[model samples]
Target: MSRQMCERPDCGRGPIDEQGFCDVCDRPPLPAPPRPVPRDGAAVRDGAAEPERTVRAGARVGVAHVRPDPWYGLGLVDADQAPDVPVISSDPVAEAHRFCPDPSCRQPVGRGHGGGPGRTAGFCPHCGTRFDFDRPDGLTIAGRYDVARVVGSGAYGAAYLAHDRNLATQVVLKALHRSVAKTARHERDVLVGLRHDSIVRILGYEPEGPHLVLEYVPGEPLSARDGDRLETLLAHGVRVLQALDYLHARGLLHCDVKPLNIIRFREEGPAGALDRVRLIDFGAVRSHTKDTGPVVAYTRAYAPPETDPEHLRPTPGFDLFGLGMTLREVCRSRWTDPATPGVDSLRLLLDRATDPERPWWRFVSARQFAEQLSGVIRQVVAAAPTCRQVTRPSALFGSMPEPLHGGLGAARPLAHWVAARADESGLLDILAPFSSPEPGDVAAALPAPLSDPDDPGVTGPAGGALAESRLALRRRDAVSAAERLTAAALPDWHWLSDWYRGLVALADGRPERAAEVLNQVRRALPGELIPPLALGLCAELCGDGEVARAHYRMVFDTTPALGAGGFGLARVLLLAGERAKAVEVAEQLAEEFRYEREARVAAVRLRVVVLPGRARPAPTGEDVDRARAALPGLDVDEAAAASLRAEIQYAEFLRTRDRLKLSDAVRALGPHAATEREYVALVDLANRLRPPLGRGRQGRRGRTGRSRFGAASGRLSS
Candidate 1:
């Protein structure tokens, strides 16, 4: 077959089949003649002198382009068709210095080591050009950028709208005032080296008479204009998060992200104009080093208490806290009633929004902050990392039988259903896994209930009444429950009693104590699977992966059958880094229990194992049909049935869309409706499935400080 011609100019060689290029031009296959070299020797080859053509091409393609640039490489394009060379401007250093802003410098206002005030001042003595400061209007330092207009100003310095005469493009210049120019320039030098889609682009900087001329961003700040409301806020927040996600992925932190710092491009729309937001401003950005000091510029209300002196330490958690707070503001702006309290007031209110007795008061932790905000700001805030227990799958939310609540006088519809079916025998059989055995077991459980019933008394064991009263105390407030649970007697008092004790410890911010008590219960009652499951939970809360995995394994191994409960356990195990074992257990459970909840959770986890990092996968048409067919025979309550249907439908969508993996699809179940345990399990599963990819995401790594889980457990068990 005849070979194709190279696409480059000035070459006529046949295309190399493998590279799709000609030997001379090395251009991809094309049907045109190559352009000839200019007759004038003065004509530059690639925007450089004739001799420098090779150098310019080398620079454009990177260091490997030097020498004959080994034809070892494949296809190439014409010089003109090649990617544009990265523009490299003059170095700010080796230039002259201007009068120092500090009083100690003593040079005259407009005079310095450099010829002109603008040029000298822009160039720092220690560092070179102050890229962080605005350039002087009249001076042409490097003959590339020309100062146009001042865009805005803030704590850092003035931002300017400028034109790059050479590049023929408009850009925004952010520069510190003369006083902060030196330090700001130093910071800019470091920041400009980073490349991310979300971050502002850094062109180049020049010293121009006591000032620094820097590259300019062309978009408007998000704070500009009005009209756009909820959608605008959400879009802006999403973009900011995406940027933050990118920065975090690159190991950089944009510590100064805020509404004002974000830029928006105005595009004409049907009614008016719409703003597209993009994150800008990196003067305060850092490389996220281990030695990061207390961050100072973080806004007070948005900043979590951990950034406070009492909790002075900066972690990715710090950035997450800010992100959560920003999300709350955005969501509240849309969701909250305007009459009750506006978004601004809510922020102020939360500043003093103390419930010292409540477990949530300790918002010093980022996880706690994220959880609290997630509750109120449903749409914007990502799931809370700490409230994992509150969102588990097997949680006792609406799943409990109706009449059962009549025992506690809390709404008995579920208990009544249980009672109506109580004589059915089949109903009891269906609930056998969840119920305790023997009349004595029921009687022992009854004493704590019959005692005070309402106010079982206090935490101490004066009698059965006291134990009931102590449990009652938890309903009042986290502190009251914590106090009571801490005083309660030893093991075997009640299964739920121990469970609640663990919860009390968790609520009290004592995760270690909660883990201890929960672990003890797990050890004592291997047959009672809840305790071991809960023990795994406590270990998870304390960020102890090994311990959590062990406890979960115990539950999986000891449980007689794999059903929704066991499937849930397997899901958690899979999340905790035991994918192989999780898959094994999940496969077993899928064979026996075809319950929608179990199957969905198992399927989702399996997908995670199959394709990690992708979004939650949708169940296939076959999976949906299978789930639908099984639904009629499933013994789940009506409400649960409805939920199961929804989940199945979602799984089908995942299968069709092919966006997420199985584990992600399973995690898409969201939080449990009522049971804190199920909610926690869900959170733990999500964590395990996809360990936080970057700074703002959640993870279980290198946990050295006081455990937030430990504190939460202490509060619960206390």
Candidate 2:
């Protein structure tokens, strides 16, 4: 018999030498049949079985009995012994499990119970991680510390007061929220290099799973205390200034320095210890190296005027201004007080501190201010300007005047001495001669008015007449000054002379011409605040509310604490029916001057007027009580008070009615229907309350109608 080679490609055994059989590829030789069906009995022809009813060994019989089965022909004993094969098809469940690749998907496949896909048995459809059906007992950090309490939350992350079992200490763990984990890590790396006593310490850092741990300082914020004594407050201020100076030296600006960020530590050792003050909250700290970026920190009252929308660069000077304001707060014990002196007043007081001609007031600068305070206290409160003056005795005390004494008093002798020196030069020289001089005495010594005042060219006159006229012009006579400048032929005095000329025109009520000149000057000197303020007043007088608003907005926007100036701008906006914008300005002013009654009243009125009806469904009795409490002892103008009362009543009525309707709609239809119906009602109410259309006297009717509607709407909305 011929032998065959192995058919399997991976098999290496060759066919048997003589039989041509490969055990690896060929079927094993079947046991020899008891008797090979006799070829004669089978009558095999061409390797086929004969057509006959035969019952032979290894021969398969069928109902027809005409053909043999393939397996039977292949030497199988019977066809019934053949192996069964399974059919293959696609499975949707398996495909869905593999479809999603995100690991953090909430709806995982096979975890169908809670935000999961049911198709896959144990896999996530959204994020293909295996489903964890059992809820975690609690989230762990650093494989040790467990979350205990949320200390605080901010844009970067949430701070937690967590207890460490290993160290047996309570530390604040500031972990970055998922949104800013990487950024927090980067910030941590940057801040790790900074070391300062005032700065909150970064005990250690663990950048694991978007979390960071920081040492927590336990104390009260400086802002929490009220009615702090000036000496004590000043001492605390010095410490903060030292920290700020250190920060600035290191090329960093602690942009946010409000009272809230200052931490006050209490020690039992001594009553006047200086180390009690500490500055914290470095989240808003910025490196001064960057050229441009949005202001990262803003507290309405504490932020400087330079922080307006238009101002871009943050200068060291800006920080100085904030420090100045903070120091002012410490000294004054209030953010604002109409009774308190203005910046000019404070400056004048400081200037007069040493001059014998003027009465002695309080210390003007921080160091001098600190000297009045105790030593330990002084060390902490002295900031930059004051800190520099600390070591200099002359800077601290040289300017102060000797205390007057005796029953007769030093008034007369001082007056005589001052009179003897009256011949000196300048206003100060003339005024210096009088010790506690009466207003009449100073007026009596003045040079007489010029006889030929109409002559613009004359610089000198007899009997000091020209000097007196010049003084008068400086003190008053804006129009006269303008006329003189207009008539003058001098070339060198154009700009300065023109400025006076513009002032005169404005004072004369010719705002159109004044505006023309002032605008020119403003273009030339953008830093000047007076010209812009004058221009705004001019626009207001000319009945150009929009232009006036724009100018006043610029001024108030730049210098937030300009008192009545800010309120004036807000008034223009309010009259223009720009309630929202007006409210924003008013709120800013109110916060900037929290103690100012007028500012607070204006802000409250604007808020009530502009509040959206939907935002407040119904005003409660408590709301009315609070509003009334804010207005205690305030004697507002009759018109303003009436208008405010009307608005409040209308708001209350509108709110109550709408709330009832909303409740019914919600109960009957559904929450969705109630929302839509409420919106429709509010729109209808707004339309009815809208002011009339037009300008000038014709617009007055519309204005009144709108005001009335607003008043009515407010009551209903409340």
Top candidate, metric TM-score:
1
User: What TM-score would you give candidate 2 relative to the actual structure?
Assistant: 0.33
In terms of lDDT, the poorest run of 10 residues in model 1 is: 397-406
TM-score of each: 0.35, 0.33
- Over 4 Å off, model 1: 1-141, 177-182, 209-218, 223-232, 245-253, 266-276, 286-307, 310-312, 317-718
Instruction: Quote the lDDT for 269 in model 1.
Output: 50
lDDT of each: 0.40, 0.41
Q: Per-residue alpha-carbon lDDT of model 2 for 204-291, expressed as tens digits?
A: 6665645566666665556424434333454455556556656666677766676666766643333332335566556666666663
List, residue by residue over 1-718, the lDDT tens digit for candidate 1. 6654454456655454322224454333332222233423222445553431222221210011112211100111111111111232322322223234343342423333455434433444543333323344553334655655445565665555667788888765554545556656766675567565545666766543223444454454444233333323444444455566556656666666555666655444564544445566666666666535767565566555542432254544445555545555545545455322123223432342222232122233222232222222221121122111111111110111111110111111222222221111111111111111121121112112111111223222433333333334324344665455454553344333555566566655566776666654433223233455555555555666676565555444433232423444554554455555554665555554334344433443243222233352333465467546756764446555544444454345444432123224333343322444443443333333332335333342423222223322111100
